[model samples]
Target: MCGRFSLYSSYSTLSQGLKLPLEVAVKLTPRYNVAPGTWITAVRHPTDNEPLVMDEVWWGYRPHWAKEKAPEPINATVEKVATSNYFRGAFAHHRCLVPADGWYEWLPLNGKKQPHFLCREDREPIWLAAIWTERPDGKPGCAILTEPARGVAKEIHPRMPLALDAESLKPWLDPHLTDRETIRQVVHHLDAELITHWPVSTRVNRPTNDEASLIEPLKP
Candidate 1:
């Protein structure tokens, strides 16, 4: 599952990369260590709403039904999310695009963990297909939808974010289309599309190292 990610590319770049209909309003700055519980931008197209809007949502979910003992699930299993109590409604009404320039995954090596950054070789933005739910107080919470890893990412982690390509992004973002089976078909299998990875300095492992240098390819 995607616990942390990076989308430090400028918003203009992302707006163009995602083919956003309107210019993004917020100033875009580089953020290397994007953690959960903070406001992150996501694109959503609710059927009754206007064109796709950039929304800021917390990247973690606390189900209205969660018990104190139930650890908040950052990722709702796609295998059961449609029928599950915690995810069913959001699966229908809260689908969104969690954009990222790339994401971080770790590979265990000789007594150490080496972190790898995966992104499009073209350096374009990636849209992570996600499902979000709203809190009673109107605050929104989200989770990065995950599936089996593929491409160069499999070697690093067994599961990775459901990074939707351009073609599949439409259905993923449209809230009017809520056929569970269709959504399942869209998200079920991993796409073997353009994905590239590079080794980076482990400085990304820290919560404080939030800068572009964290993603720079490291020299041995």
Candidate 2:
């Protein structure tokens, strides 16, 4: 599961990488350590075919039917999202792209876990597939979809956030495309070869450590 990640890259970098203009009115700053429950940037297509818009949404996903106090799920598996009680509706109609510069995963070494940062070798932002819903209060919440790990990702954890390739971004975020089968085909599993990872300081374990240094590779 992707409990934490970062988007420290600049707005121009993200814009060029994702190939979309920012639609959110607020200026986005570098975020070195992002945690769940906090507002994060999500890119989605608007109903009227306007430019893609960036919206701030809580990282955890809470479906409309869930009770007000129920725990929101942070990760929804792509395989089960089609029929899952909590994600089926969102998956079919409200898919989104959660942008990240890199994500942290803890790998067990001896008895302790060491944190590692994974991102594209080209240094471009990786787009994570997600689903979102609005609360009764009108606040939006979203969940990152996870899939079985492959290549280098398997070394850190058994599951990794489902990242999409450049070609798959459009269809995945299309507001008008609601066919389950078509949506399923749009999810492009990230190629492990496109990613690179290295051990990082454990300071990332604390959500309070948001400095850029937290992502600097630790001495091997």
Candidate 3:
């Protein structure tokens, strides 16, 4: 599960990488420790013919029609998202992308959990596949999609965020591509071989401890 991540890349870098004209309305900041239930940047296709739009959305999902007491999950498993009653609607119609510099996953070590930062070896931004919907309060909320971890990520945890390949970003966000099978065929995750990880300071365990040092490799 991608419970914590970082997104300190500049708006210009993200714009050039994702090839979308990100709206400057939402001020960009260097977030080295991003937690759930807070506003995060996402790219979405609001309508069938509209260009993709980048905006801030709550990092938790609860459909507007769901009961007020329904659970707002931050991550949705790819295995069931396509058919789960609570997520299928958004999965089919509201797919989006969550950009991140990297994500943190904890590994159990000597009865303690050691946090590790995972990212592409090239140091480029990763685009996590996600789905969103308007919450009862009229704010857009999203849940990042997760799948079985592969390569180095599997060594730290059994699952990881579903980061998409550059070629799949536009198709994944296409509002008209609602068929589950077709989506499965056209979209694909980034190559696991491109991912690399390193143990980081436990300071990241606290959401408030946000800074550049949080991502520094923990000294041996």
Best by TM-score: 3
After the best TM-score superposition of candidate 3, give how far the Cα of residue 39 lies from its true spot, in angstroms: 0.4
Each model's TM-score, in the order given?
A: 0.89, 0.93, 0.97
Instruction: State which candidate, 2 or 3, has the greater lDDT.
Output: 3
lDDT of 2 by residue, 1-220 (tens): 8999999777777777777564874468889999998999888754437767886888888866789897688999978987987788888778898889999999999999999999888888999999888765667789999999878888899999999888888888777888888877765777889988999999999998899998899986
Cα lDDT tens digits, model 3, 34-63, are: 999899999987655766788899999999
Clashes of each: 0, 0, 0
TM-score of 3: 0.97
Alpha-carbon error at 90 in model 3, in Å? 0.7
State the weakest 10-residue window (summed lDDT) of model 1: 184-193
- Give the candidates in order of TM-score, highest first: 3, 2, 1
Cα lDDT of model 3 overall? 0.92
Give the per-residue lDDT digits (tens) of candidate 1, residues 51-154: 78776777887755666565556777666778988788888888888889899988899999998988888888888878877654457778888887887788
